[model samples]
Target: MNIFKRTGKMALGSRLRMLTAKFTDDASSIYNLYNIDMQPKWFPVFYVLSERDDVTITEIAVEIGHSQPSVSKIVREMAAKGLVIEKKDAADGRRNVVQLSAAGKAIIVKIQDQYQDVNDAVEELSAEANHDLWKAIEEWEFLLEQKSLFQRVRERRKQRESGFVEIVPYEAKYQSAFRELNVEWISTYFKMEEADYKSLDHADSYILDRGGHILVALYRGEPVGVCALIKMDDPDCDFELAKMAVSPKAQGQNIGWLLGNAAIEKARSLGAKSLYLESNTILKPAISLYHKLGFKKVTGRPTPYERANFQMELKLG
Candidate 1:
């Protein structure tokens, strides 16, 4: 009788909806058994308003990951139940600010212990699934934030079709492209340090002339990506993969991969025995890509850049 369960993976969305409905129904039953007079769907918005008083509907929507209209509807329901109060913003009368009413505050005190019990029950249920459902859900949400489902599907479709994303060795003509690419990423994530300015302003003398290598990626004849292999002062044949950047418009097109591989190949050609890089943990997508390319985390070392929190190395094979 459960059509979605019969369809298996083919009905992922339907199955997920069914699972959510089951959980919601069970939550409703639990509330009724405990004499709690709140709906499961209103919990997110209610919790947010409880913590942040007198916030606008837009703020509640952002905190709860719902649309403003959806949050407004929840607020209306809570207001009808005498659980929330809405007031017109003094500065902007058009905006409606929401806060928990005295009844809602009292109810929170009444249901605080039950909330913890419900969370514990959720953990127990998740544990019975034979996999880390909470972790899986977290990863899924992270991936969705990195790229929407529709965008990822479209990218895969484009990858199947013929396209031109070319990685070329550094040329004198691409001097500005190299600087612009690196500066764009560096400035966005971290501030421009003295070393960054040195490399960006004098790529030829600081990098190319000093036996370092730079690779540039071109898409449709426009320079869209670049990565550098900076020769170190150490005695060993090691290179630092640094200053990698891809244009926002050309991202998700494998341009970073092209430039990264090209940089590694160039490093190897120049007798590099080990490749290392300094990056921040905030760059999750970039760090994931580096891991896929066989880079592993190593102990932290003193670095000139204050933003560097992670130092990873890839042993050249």
Candidate 2:
């Protein structure tokens, strides 16, 4: 039976429960396929509770964003399984505090080791697949959070007619507009210097000389956004994607994502094995886009580059 069909009336909480049920099944099936006994859900809850054994049931529910009754039931089940024990709060007799039993702790340790085996099997399948799966899950979480904010914005805004937006490769005629958009976006968000902004045009020329491409987003013949793909000079390095900028006035319309997708496609066409980008935390929207695009965070930072304030990379097929 469809879990959502049964719980469709309860709104967000029910939807969350449905999602949990779906993924819980997936995890259990994956473990069974590998002849493993444990699934993934218990660890997160166990780890959280184990850290603060005296934490109240209400606190656990809040920390995990589950209903109080739901958490209570789960804790009761865990207690029955000898995985957790609930005791009266020392300070508040009416309140119950949860702690992991020794058996529970042992199970978590074994699960942690088994998780490495699962990760290894996943990595062997394809790095890109693993990255894409993780990204899709994260995007689902983000959209759920944004639903309320989107509804609030819709309540106050007039519905405008949709208009066409064109995307074109960067050219001399659109150079000034392209530069202006980059300058405005970087300056406002990153506080980058004028010289650093000016250097981007030069860097574009350098990239073009090495078989890389740059693209611009146009709105009715006016350039409003930009992104670029540059083949790496070092044989050891993969193609570098850079200079992604969307006009502040043109944001919230999904233009940045469109530009990014174009860049990734272009890189793939160029026979690149990996695509990398440089960005900063100040540009939160851009960072979010990178994450949505399946780019994972890495430890290293970018070298000195005209458009870069930091760096992230994604492996491609």
Candidate 3:
């Protein structure tokens, strides 16, 4: 029987349980194949104690989300293995302080290196699949949290206080406003070239003609920011993120994030598996924002566009 089928009665809980089971099974299989008994659970406890050598056993338990008795049992086992050392807490004589032994510290480093193999296997999966998996996991977590009474009330209050604006296709009427916002915000923010500022209209036109769409952030009937997705002709290439700019007046209001997220959503809607953008190092905040949004650096020169002074890409599913 499929492992999932064994847990089918519980539906959502079953799926989660099955996932954990699969992970454990896979890990055990790998360990057996390598003729090793590297108990994965102990690694986290070792890691935490290694970082804070003087931490109390209770602190280790709390950090690793284990009960005191469970942690104590593991600690005693590890101590017997000479992987950890415990001492009476100096300030609180009743408490036992936990620290990694030399063996434990060395094993943690080895565990990290072996874990890189797991990371490599994960990275081999298609970017779209990884993105979808993470997105589904996040949605599940959010839905689970929403089931809590306190979370439901908190979400409702947040929605009531924070006004949300829908993303709409950019129109010609908003083009000038977008341009003004770009020049006012981006140029000043990044110290962009004057020629770069002058070339946006033509570049934007080129993108729009190529099955691309721009969304302007509107508040009170005024365009506050702009973001766009330009379709890539190359099937192997991702859609390009273009014309992302927020009004200077709206800098701290997360307008840039809204615009960037809208561009990502639009790119996904267009059947794009990834999104790429051109940016400069001078735009540190923008670069930081892109990194925060999961963009990674690529080893190549920017595309032959005036605004593509630098480049970054984010996988989308």
TM-score of each: 0.53, 0.48, 0.46
Q: What tens digits encode model 2's per-residue C-alpha lDDT throughout 274-310?
A: 8877777767777999999988776565367565556
Q: Which candidate should be chosen as best, given TM-score against the real structure?
A: 1
Clashes within 3 Å, all models in order? 0, 0, 0
Clashing pairs in 1: none
Among these predictions, the greatest lDDT belongs to: 1
- Cα displacement (angstroms), candidate 1, residue 112, comes to 46
Worst 10 residues of 2 by lDDT: 155-164
RMSD from true fold, candidate 1 = 11.4
lDDT of 1 by residue, 37-98 (tens): 89999999878877888899889888778998998899999999999999988888888789
By lDDT: ranked, best first: 1, 3, 2
Off by over 4 Å in 3: 1-164, 189-199, 305-309
Give candidate 2 misplaced runs (Cα > 4 Å): 1-163, 193-198, 305-309
Judge candidate 1 at residue 267 and give its lDDT: 76
Candidate 1 segments exceeding 4 Å error: 1-155, 158-162
lDDT of each prediction vs. the true structure? 0.85, 0.71, 0.72
lDDT of 2 at 189: 59
Location of the lowest summed lDDT over 10 successive residues in candidate 3:
157-166
